[model samples]
Target chain A: MTDPPDRRPGGRTARVRAQVLDAVRAELAEGGHEGLTVEGVATRAGVHRTTVYRRWRDVGGLLADLISAAGEIDWQPPDTGSLRGDLTALNEEILESLTVRPSFAVALMAASFHSEQAARAQTRLWEDRYAQCEVVVARAAGRGELPPGDTDARGLLIAATAPLYHASVLMRADPDPRLPARAAAAAVLAAAAGAFSAGGGTA
Target chain B: MTDPPDRRPGGRTARVRAQVLDAVRAELAEGGHEGLTVEGVATRAGVHRTTVYRRWRDVGGLLADLISAAGEIDWQPPDTGSLRGDLTALNEEILESLTVRPSFAVALMAASFHSEQAARAQTRLWEDRYAQCEVVVARAAGRGELPPGDTDARGLLIAATAPLYHASVLMRADPDPRLPARAAAAAVLAAAAGAFSAGGGTA
Candidate 1:
């Protein structure tokens, strides 16, 4: 039997989903997680309550869909053939997310505190982001950009920036927010590069 | 007619005060900020209710003294003659605290969240700690350890590590429990060193 064609949106359903999701994000940014309710969201979107409920089983479901879109933010690592350019790009992506969609991040983190499901969801999204960096690290290792055989350097690498991103959004302090991200990316890359050189030389 | 000499610790008043303060900390840590109670603390210390109440005034006063003592985890920036050494020391302090006096940090943060007085106290403590770091940075800068004149780098620095401390003790995910503190310090120091070098050339 032939596989069915993709049932991706082309019309009103697509438009409504876009509109509702946008409304939800705006509400989250403006009012935080507590402010997200079907009635409030429906009112904001100019959509019916039934339509909102029909689309999202609950607030959690709505958020999951919203978060699912986080994956769309660029996940590909840069190939500058040097750690500096590659890391700079990585930091920029993280900085962009922090500056633009910080509230969503804050809401998700706060929610993750209380909800195991939210934590699981956040973990997946973050791991995917880290996976992008891992690819870079792997390539950098091969290119003598990291300490030899530090296969799980991604954890340490991500650890470096995780605090910066978190503090920026929560404490409302970024201090050359751009500088922090860029510096973080650059430093990790350089350290890896140095490590790789040393390791390879020893080997 | 002279200032009274510093009393020896074996004195009745000093001994009693120490007992009350220890009781307060123990009780607070056992639960959280909300746990501190004059009656409970007095009972825990095996002290008379009137004596405890008269000394601390209220739970708030008792908590204040306890925090002031606990918060004084003095940091003398290591002068290992390199930024990396300074950062490692800082990160190690963070890690050691999480392991040794975990409850102290948790109680302080929780108190800040729960009470306005505690919040003000916590902020003061932070302001002081940040000032201490500033002195360390200045020393590094004077010795030409940091980039020349990267003066506006404090916010990112604090942002980078504050959340790591906040998360492990506050929101608390179990994956790589030590990562928040270690990562925050490493990331910030690494990034800061790199950023400084970019402007003034890495030393």
Candidate 2:
């Protein structure tokens, strides 16, 4: 039988990988993804160049890993007993994640734009996030809080959050404190009116 | 009097500038905005390098002018009688513009992200676009087609289009042909429900 690679939680390899990722975050925080380099990350992590190259391959590889790691965080989905409450909770979480760590968020966005691999990772992350949102909607439907039809959960979620993304990401505007709640309310009202139903909304 | 910079329609200066901008659009269409160069624009436009440099200053300057020139086009705002029709018309225009000349659209978007000067131009463009949308809502309200008390036209418009931008721009996904109509209906329903009214929603 072939030998297994290190799978221990606190092994040397895990520690090294953690250090490298931390360095990558630091570099992204210092600037944007404009001029990030593997050598720079390696130097910042205090790891050898060859080690960094052999492991990460390039900046795109590092960014893809970073995105995948972000998906791996043990983030709990919102379950606040109502669609409005659940949606508000989800939007607040997104707002906090995007604003509290601006550099990381911007870097992740830039990588998604600049690299195909990172874009795939971003799509996967979005799919996972949408799945969580679906649970909230499905539960609401079960409770008769929703209209008696198949509401497009993913569409509602995107509609709820897209304005926030436009303001912060494209227009470079400051995040409005009331935006998350407003966005959630808008989506909820529309959904309750059957605007998100497959046969109703897309006029 | 100091010599007047050629302000005459179809004057030598105007023609040269048009040629340069045409070349810029062609180049952007061919290769995107990643490595667009002034010299390349000059050569393609059959203009001298010094003339291009003196007039446009740099790529950012060229892009700024390009954006301003775009604003100068004879693009009419949506004039449909109903808010839903008007918003759908607006979104159709946006979708068509973004998809029809992808290189030009991507370059403009990239310029908005890459340069502060271009960002200002982009903001102005948005303001202009929003003002046009405001007219559609104002007219609807005037005709008693809308429920009253400050409908937040800009907010509604952002809600209507942000999903389309998310689908086409950030996510790198195929353009969803049904998105524009869906977005318009969602915004109209939300607006009618008073979700976009400052005092009505965000509860």
Compare the candidates by DockQ and give the number of the best one.
Answer: 2
Taking the tens digit of each residue's C-alpha lDDT, what string does model 2 give over A60-92? 888988888888888777999988888888888
Query: How high is the CA lDDT of each candidate model?
Result: 0.60, 0.80
Clash number for every model? 4, 0
What is candidate 2's lDDT per residue for B163-184, written digit by digit as tens? 8877777766677788889988
Q: Candidate 2, A9: how far from true, in Å? A: 1.2
In the range B128-187, model 1's lDDT, one tens digit per residue, is 666676665666667775555564345434534543554354335343554444444444
TM-score for the A-chain in each candidate structure:
0.74, 0.90
Candidate 1 residue-wise lDDT at A150? 58
Pairs of residues at least 3 apart in sequence or in different chains that clash in candidate 1 = A146-A192, A146-A196, A147-A195, A147-A196
Cα shift from native, residue A58, model 1 (Å): 4.7
Q: lDDT per residue, candidate 1, A1-203, as tens digits?
A: 33345466756677778888898888888877666788888889988889889878677767777767676766576777865567666666656766675457667655553344655667677767666677676776688756666544554455445555544543345435455444555456436534223232111
Which structure among the candidates has the greatest lDDT? 2
